[model samples]
Target: MSEVDNYEIVRQKLTLGPLTTPKHRKIRRLLKIFWNEKEINLLSHFGPADEYNSLKQLQERSGLPKDEIKQILRNPLRKGTISKRGTKYCLEPIIPGIFEKYFQRSRDTEENLKKAAILYWDLFKEVLPQQDTKVDNDWSLFRPLLPLEANEKIIEINQEFDVQSQTLPYESVKNLIDKFEQFAVITCQCRLVAELSGEPCKVAPSEMGCFIAGPGSQTMIDGGIRGARLLNKDEAIEFLKETEKRGLVHNAVFDKGDQSSIFFCNCCGCHCGVLFPPKLFHERGAYQSNYSPKWDNDLCTKCETCMKKCPQKAIYHKFPVKSDSSDEQMVLREEMCIGCGVCAINCSDKAIKMVKVRDNVPPDRQKIGNKTFIEMLQ
Candidate 1:
């Protein structure tokens, strides 16, 4: 296609969710070129499609070379500035409010949001590289019930325990998601496969994802995931049920407030960023668990199988028995364990088991009453 035609094609594609008419694509390409300039912003305040100058008019007005004009129009940054209706170009600003409305319209109807979330999760897993291959023989860490409560209450509880703070409020999470238009669920698989012979997963993205709730400055940070929404109590329950049915495991639910407020179902690991910060500050080596694993030496056969499958590198073969003994034992370092039950499930001899050390307090109901957490954003 001609350069003009190509720009039109890109514009159409972006407008129509990557499924664009050729003409639309061309328009998108052209708009990207001039999007961020002071002149474009000035033009935006002037008027709509008919009132605003055409591409040729803009090129002449800006006094830029033909190639430079073409470059700006074709750039991805300017895609939000021009709208195509029939055969006309219109001035449109890609302000936060406009983007929010667009996303809300797309994700709020017909369960499209859910489908997008699932797709994002799938893509995340595929892109993440595997680091450790060791299996966790401990099962106790997985047994604890997931926590659900208002974001504020979680912060309070963590403080009470003297745990270093890293939790984000539900409103904050939503705002981040909304501003970025995408967010990722990052998991540390390093400890999960540490005991295995091969490399463990250094970073595994989460299968559960969320979208942002509003437009704001806090949501623009690079590490932040965008497009997050809050899930109220009922919605949180429903989300868990749906995720479970899909075979994705998660722990903890962050309730921001109302039925539609944002929530995050967290998964724990020694290497995960959320737990890492607290672990480092506390000098606890990044372990975040109330339970630890115990081994039955009598049942362990010194075959050293468990040692090969630990994700946290917590297990090792040591002290070979005298000739008379039937069992050779593997040692577990409690401090190094993250408590994911990978090793226990992988053990062939059924010798490994997890035991809970202490229980976490249940979430407080009074703090997270029935109001939309989005109200807090305002």
Candidate 2:
């Protein structure tokens, strides 16, 4: 087959993933620039993002020798275009998969990365804004995690079930670190893109990026993803603390919203896939924990620390009509808050505390609310 035919086939396969690749001129150019004729031909043999195929299956399908097929896959495998399971491999999705791997390559030249960044930024503008009008708006792939020191008061609203139970591992940042043995950190894909586009992040450095845990993390560490760093459980916890100090939200992204694979992203509103889109799209980007910040008027000196520190832009000073009235108070916009606990942790006077408002646990299957990974691909 011709190079154009192979690229088109690969593009269609990519569209079958959780994130769609629209048949636009920019997308076509992006695919052409990223993948060569041979690579495109090999990628055409892979299944959708969610489906894994064995080596023998790929060799047979591609009509290539086992050694040749493996050799061909080496670069793309490390590049994150193709992800491997136990003994199988499959294509990565466009956003959470290929786009990240494409830019995170530490060995790639700065000029090449910047060129790719331009295309990706354009694609993001074209695609992400449309999410605002999506029919399913209840949940996102990302969820907020409350700070370790943030106060949690279990509100006793229901009489039947016990709401006084201890906090679960998934609910608390400290516990979540303890639950994992392997941990790894990589450059923030969003901030990296922004920096490459000559718009740097004001929140945190790109190196202080996603904190990935669980058994799956070992694959990333072993794969030699450029700048991928491994950390112990204790170090991981400390790293999370630093992100909080920088006013970054701890966003836990689940693999298809299932407990199978989870990563904690220290996200900033200025350049985060999950957090920034909410500002323009008016849609919930990440799931909120059952907590909301409760302000103490007496303790608050109107320092506006919380206002400056809030990643959600949820806190603001509400000034009264009279300047001498001394009625100005910081208002907590509960509707805008993702319950990240950034404000409470940054409040020096202990004026703000996170209180349990409701319960929201990640789903067991590959579904959140009424949406499934399959539905997303569709």
Candidate 3:
């Protein structure tokens, strides 16, 4: 089929429910087919959606005939710059109103339309069976509005860390919060899913890294734009305290040195590409923690309680070693472990305990923030 014809087909498929206006659907489909397919997929992955697929992989998996697929990929109407990164292709911002129009919806239209849009993007790439990655513990999320000038202060604070290795001073954290005039309750899409589903979210609200400032910041705020639910220092603290009361945790607090903002993340073990290994993206760093979990076999009864409680599914159970006879043994996958205290909390034998593991940041933090936040915007 010609690119135009394919675009029509996609548009027809996308039209559903009250929100799917004919014009809107046509525009979305045209953009999808005409622009870089990889860029569309990347947007879906980065946005508040659940689509994650590489462009080339999607092309190979597409059942369309080679000629038709090539025609769609090479369509001239898809007027956008393509950015290639190690086989990945992304579409530059070509159409001005694409995001605004695509996301426009009445309250009732959201659930279904959002799902359809996400599924459409997934069609282009692989969807691995969902697995928890075991990095959920020791994380947090919060949205605080602070002064934009605080970004400079944060840079100064980080400069001190450049020469020394110590936890952020309580005074520094307090000073930044006090200086900021406003804050916003930033909600992550992944965390939103957990809340809507009534599932126990694994990531803490505090553990989320700040990426709105400095050289590698992942968040973006319009300069001097003040319209959201901005909170002052006292209000911000109250908001965070309420979040914790609702069972959410905080991992870290950051002063971006600009607008006062708090990042609230709902992280999981799996699907959180940032928390996993193989370092798919160079811009993101690792997840860091101040503590690790220690196992005492003597207290263990070979029970598998820890394995079941693990959100990342990192823990395993095995039988004890047989001195001379044949018996099963229990074991823990330390490599896959994220040192969350869930296993220890649930362990009947009390064999697991969280102890200070190291002082370095975990590699996954940078990856998730950079890939999902910064790279997507660029």
Q: Among these predicted structures, which one has the highest lDDT?
A: 2
lDDT of each: 0.35, 0.69, 0.35
lDDT tens per residue, model 2, 96-157: 66777777664455766787777777766666766442323354566676675543432223
The global Cα lDDT (0 to 1) of model 3 is 0.35
Clashes of each: 74, 0, 61
Off by over 4 Å in 3: 1-108, 117-188, 191-261, 270-291, 301-303, 321-330, 345-350, 357-378
- How accurate locally is residue 22 in candidate 3, as Cα lDDT from 0 to 100? 40
Measured with C-alpha atoms, the lDDT of residue 226 in candidate 2 is 50
Q: Ten-residue segment with the worst summed lDDT in candidate 2?
A: 369-378
Alpha-carbon shift of residue 11 in model 1 (angstroms): 36
Which 10 consecutive positions of candidate 1 have the poorest summed lDDT?
A: 138-147
Winner on TM-score between 2 and 3 is 2
Give TM per candidate.
0.32, 0.81, 0.39
lDDT of 3 by residue, 1-378 (tens): 644343333333332111121434434543554335543432332212112335555456564454554455442212222323454443322211122122211122355434533433232112211212122334321112211222232122223244344333321234444445555543333333333334424544322322221211222232211112345556665654443223222323322322222232323343232332211221111232343456676766766766655544556666446874245545556555444344554555656555444444422333222232223323
TM-score, prediction 2: 0.81
